[model samples]
Target: MRARLTLGFFTITLAAVALVSVAVLPGLQSRLIDAKLADLAELARQYAPELRKAVGTSLPQSELQDLVGRTADLTGSRVSVLLVVTSDGEITVEAGTDSATERDITLDFSVAIEAATSGRVSRGTEAGPNGQVGEVAVPFLFRNPESGRRRVGRVAVFSSPLRDVEASVAVVRDRTLVAGSAASLLALLAGFLVARRLTRRLEAVQAGAGRVAGGDFSARFPVDREDEIGELARTLDNMRRQLAELDSARKRFIATASHELRTPIFSLGGFLELLADEELDPQTRQEFLRHVRAQVDRLSRLAVDLLDLSKLEAGSLELRPESTDVAELARRVAHEFHPALAAHDSHLEVRVPEDVVEVDCDPERVAQVMRILIDNAITHTPSGTDMVVSASRRGDAVRFGVGDFGPGIRRAMLPHIFEPFITSDDAQGSGLGLAIAHELAERMAGELLVESQPGRTTFTLQLPARPTPPRPAAPPVVTEA
Candidate 1:
């Protein structure tokens, strides 16, 4: 990844440099040639009259040649001037002395050919040894009063070697190449650093995940930076902790369930073995059968508890909800418990407000929860324990309570009371009632909470209240045989 990133940076940087060089290099060469051509044009204008005088008077050619040589050798200029004479389809060429060897001598003459053939001023560039030369050709003419104006027997072409302009362009090209190389190297370094920084955190997360996959949930990553990577590390750590806790809970549940299930099965086996005794009396046999029945009942309760627990854990429990009156529901549970309360010699009270406490919940599930709490209060406490069934509204929720004045649960057991297989001295009933009630309350979108102190223990099921609506009338049914 780092290598890929560095390559990407280098490619982009070099591409930009190449593009700029493509655009600037040609324009630089063209502009230099244009400026040089402008200089040559002015020079041709300045010397045109002198050369014309020397030509028309038929003076020595050395005089014109010397002037051209001096102009070509000027301190900072590398210009070469040529004088041509064309007549009867024949041509003669002469160059300035000092600039002869500086540029290529074989320059194309298409523009100069047109000028000599048609007597027109021409300008263009041509290749030379030192580089490209910018050239201009102007016709030479003279006037005689007797014959008016007529073309002279000569043409002068102004030329420059262009060595200095070529040198300047070379310097620019070299600098661009150096800058581009340096920038590409620097970009590669920067890209590697960036890729390393980003991938380091990801690597840590990967390692942590591997450890978790290997059944080690204690692995953690640093979360110092307030970045996305840091947040990811924190999230992974939280998941590990939750998983560790779940694993511990799972182990404890397995051990407890095994012990609870094994005890009753053993007892039932022992009693069934004894029932096959031929020497046993009718009363003793009946008593042994009763003990076996009790063990069977215990096993049945355990099976039911395990089934309910599995359903809750797998999230398969379904609830049928209605806008039901929880106050009336509490009253019904209290009335149903009257017989059991009487059997246990316990006192029961049902209290609710005159107004309906309507809540959207599965009424059977809520009733089941209330019954469990009432039964616990009746059986787990001493006889004559006053168990109160009450319902009232608070905020947008309704609270249904079954509380009793009894010795409170031990603080150590209070926290785990809602866990399965926890009962008072493993007596009165299987320890799954409260846990089942809690899960049922949850399935109905309610919360089951217990608060206890000496002489007072309250289990409250809080459910969301719904505004009371008139109950729908049942449709009439027609009977036909």
Candidate 2:
């Protein structure tokens, strides 16, 4: 990974540098050539007037050559004076300062010819004897004193070689290569280091996950970074904590369930062995049989609770919803608990509103949750403790609650009260009723809320209210007009 990432960065940087060179080098060369031409054209313009006056006077060829040489020295270019022969229409170079053979150079005298013909300055580039050359020509006009008429007699051409411009472009090309190479190297190093660090962090997370997968829940992911990786680490760490808690709960549940199941089976076995004694009296056999029946009942309830809990956990528990009066449902569920209330020597008061508290919910599931809450209250509280089942409507919701006037639940157990196999005290039942109730409430889009304090504990099921539909309007009577 590190090698690949480094190479990727280096390749991108190299390509960028190559692209910049490709785009900029040609323009740079063109501009340099243009600047050189402009300088040559300006020099030709400044020296043309002097050469024209000298020509009108018919100055000696040697002195004209000297003057041209001096101008060339100052401008760092070749200066020449060319005359147009009217009879043959031929151009002849009268004097020059450069050493190039005039015939070879004058073969392409387009700039000078254009200047002489147009009577204006012209500039262009052409191939010279030595190399490419830039030329600027200014027309030389001679004024006749007698008629006061001006005529173009000669053209002054300023020429310069393009080697300097080529040299500058070469230097820039070399420097760009050097800088691009250095940048590519730096990118490679940076990419390698970054990729290495990233992979190391990922590996640490992988190791932690592996440990968790192997059932070592104590391993933790690192969360010290302040980037995306850090956020991932934090999320994984939170998940690990949850899984660890669940694992602990699972172990406790297995141990408790095993013990609960074993006791009933053992009691039934002992009762059967006792009933097998031939000498045992009829009353003793009947008592043993009763004990066996009670154990059997305990076993049956645990089996049913376990099945419900498994279904809830698997998300296969379906609900059948309908618009039902919650007040009446609460009364019915409370009345069903009368047998247990009598056994516990406790009375349950039903406090429901006179008006219907209608809500959209599964009546059977709602009754089941109420039964769980009521049974939980009776089982946990002491004998003779009174209980209350209440139902009412508030705003857009209807609430059915079961509460008890007994010692309240412990503060520490409130958070896990709805967890499977969780009991507040050493109660003689599978502790899955609250878990099933909680799941049922959630499936019905309702909530099971609890509030407990000394001598008061309530578990309330709150479901959204179903509004009553409006009656149809009466048909309008139509009489013949």
Candidate 3:
């Protein structure tokens, strides 16, 4: 991962450099070429009139050759002079650079002669034996300016192609290479530093995780940074702490289970031993047996609740969802709780709509949730306290709730009431009961919502109503062709 990240950074940096260099270097070279061409053109314009005068009116070929040679020497170029043909399709190369020159220099005398006669300037590039070359031609007319008719002699100024453009481009390429090398060195140093810092922090986290995995639950993470790595470190630390807490809970559960189980076992063993005795009071034996049975029942219930919680946590609990009348389900579960309510001197009052309020849910699980809620209500509310199981339709959902007029759950404990092994002062049962109920409700695509205050608390199970399918649209009629 680190290598890939470094490579990605380098790739982006290089790409940016290449893009900028591609756009800027060619443009700079082109401008330099134009500037050099302009300078050469200006030089030609400066020498045009002087060259025309030196090669004046029908000059001999020898004098023209001498003049061209002197001009080439002064301009530091292989120069050429051509005479324009009047009403003819040929140029007379009167004098210029050596014709047998091995440098393969051929001046474009035709274009130059044409420009001179037509009174215009033109420029072009051409190939010679040596290589590519540039030429500029200016037209010269020695006509009588006052006469409407014309008769003329022509001379053109010429030089070799400019070399400054190539030189400038070479300099630019060297500079770019130097700059790119320096940037790459700097990027390498920066990437190394960043990667080192990140790896160090991650190593620390990995070491902490190793300690936790090896059963050292006391490992904690550094809380120095506020970035994502820091958040990960903090989460790891939290997991360690939770594991420590769970370890302590496991020890407590073991001790509690042993004690609870041992008491019942001792009672049953003692009662059976007494019953086996040949001499014992009948009434005393019956009392001991009854107490043993009650303890056994309590232990059995505790074991059953623990098993149910395990099923819920492992996601192995199955739910069969179907449409059921909410009011009737609530009534049946409430009736089952009559004995427990009477024991607590509490009365169960049901407030369900007479109209069929159907809801999509697993009827058995819904009934179990209702039973748990009613049992919790009966246990928490003191004698003469009133409890109600009600059902109502709210929008597209049906809500079945159990409410009690008792000292409601404490505000602080409300959040975790549905969590496994969580219980409140006002409610005491197998703490798994409400947790299981909540899990069941959720498994049926429903939610268990709670509301509590000083004198009243309500637990509502909300489930979605069976959907009504939309009617099909009619097909449009087609016209005959």
Candidate 4:
């Protein structure tokens, strides 16, 4: 990753440098050439007037040499080539530091013809005998004062070699190479540091995941940035905590479920052994058989509870919700549990008001929830304890509650009451009734909540009320019209 990141940064930097060089080099060269041509044109302006006074005739050789020498001195171009040519493209006068040498260089023959005929200054780059050069030509015009007419009698051509511009460009190329190298080095160093920082954080997360996979839920990622890496670290830490909690829950659940199932199975085995005794009377055998049947029923109910809890966990618990009176459901479940209350030597009380309190819930599921709450209230409390089954309307919900006048559940166990196989130390049942009840209530679009105090414990199922539909408007009377 670090290698890739560094390479990416370096590649981008070099690409930018290349693009700037390609875009700016030609324009730079052209501007420098234009500047040289402008200087030559200005020099021609200076010498044209003197040449114009000598029009229609050739100047004396000494005077032409002096004029060309003074023009070269004023232009101040160190590497300039100046020439004075006749309209027929003959070089009449030439000036340089080597004025002692004989003149031999020729102007571009076509350019000289154009200037002398057109009577205007023209600038261009041309291939000179020395190298490429920027040159300008100015037509020496003889304008008629009265008729406002002009005639070209001569042309002055000035040329400068392009070595200065090329040398400047070479220097720029060297500097660009040096700067691009420095920039690429800097980008590589920065990219390596950034990638290392990122990968270090990711490695922490990877190690944490491995630990969790190995059943060590305590591992956590610790990155404190404000970027995506930090968000991932926080998410991993949260997942670790949740996994730890779920791990604890699963361990406790397995232990509790095994204990619950084993006790009933062991009891059934003992009852069968007693029934198999050869000298046992018919009454004794029948009693033992009844005990075995009771244990079998316990096992059956536990199995059903397990299946329902699994379905709830899998998010496939089905329900058929309808508008039904919550009060009626509570009363029916209370009456149905009266026999069980009698068997346990407990009393049942119904406190539901039949005021048409309606809720959107599955009637059968709601009844199952009520039965679970009532059974818990009766079985968990002492014999002869009075249990009340009640229903009431509060705002937008109808609440059915089962209350017992017995020792309440421990505070530590209250929060986990709806969790499967979670129970108090004093709990004797399968420890699955409330979990199943909670699931059924939720599947029916209701919530199960519990409140417990010393000597009073109440579990309530709160279901949303069905909205009352508005009545239809009365028909208008025709006689009124």
Name the better of 3 and 4 by lDDT: 4
Q: Residue-wise lDDT of candidate 4 within 1-481, one digit each (tens)?
A: 7688778888898898887689877788778887877877787677656655653447766666665556656654322233445547653434422222344354343455556556577777777566677766666666667888865645656556788888888788778878988988898888888878877788888998999989998787886787898888888889889889999988888887888899999998888787778999998888888888888898999899988888987989888877788766776677787578778887777776535667777889888888888888877888888887778776778888888999899998898888887666565678888999888877767889999988999999988886765344343221100
RMSD of each: 7.7, 7.2, 9.8, 7.2
Question: For each candidate, what TM-score against the reference?
Answer: 0.68, 0.87, 0.74, 0.80
Give lDDT for model 4: 0.74
Off by over 4 Å in 1: 1-75, 78-127, 133-207, 218-230, 276-287, 343-345, 376-384, 406-431, 450-456, 469-481
For residues 64-146, write the lDDT of model 1, one tens digit per residue: 56766666555234434445565686765454333455545577544566566677777887786556777777666656578
Candidate 4 has its poorest 10 consecutive residues by lDDT at 472-481
Worst 10 residues of 1 by lDDT: 472-481
How far out, in Å, is residue 58 in model 2?
3.1
Give the CA lDDT, 0 to 100, for residue 76 in model 1.
33
Give candidate 3's error at residue 250 in angstroms.
Answer: 6.8
* Model 2, runs deviating above 4 Å: 55-57, 82-120, 127-132, 139-154, 469-481
Model 2 clashing residue pairs (backbone):
none
Off by over 4 Å in 3: 1-27, 45-56, 60-78, 82-134, 138-157, 160-163, 209-278, 425-428, 466-481
**lDDT per prediction?**
0.76, 0.83, 0.72, 0.74
Better of 2 and 3 by lDDT: 2
Higher-ranked by TM-score: 1 or 2? 2
Clashes of each: 1, 0, 4, 0
For candidate 3, the 10 contiguous residues with the lowest summed lDDT are: 472-481
Tens-digit lDDT track of model 3 for 15-51: 7679768998889877875665566577678765677
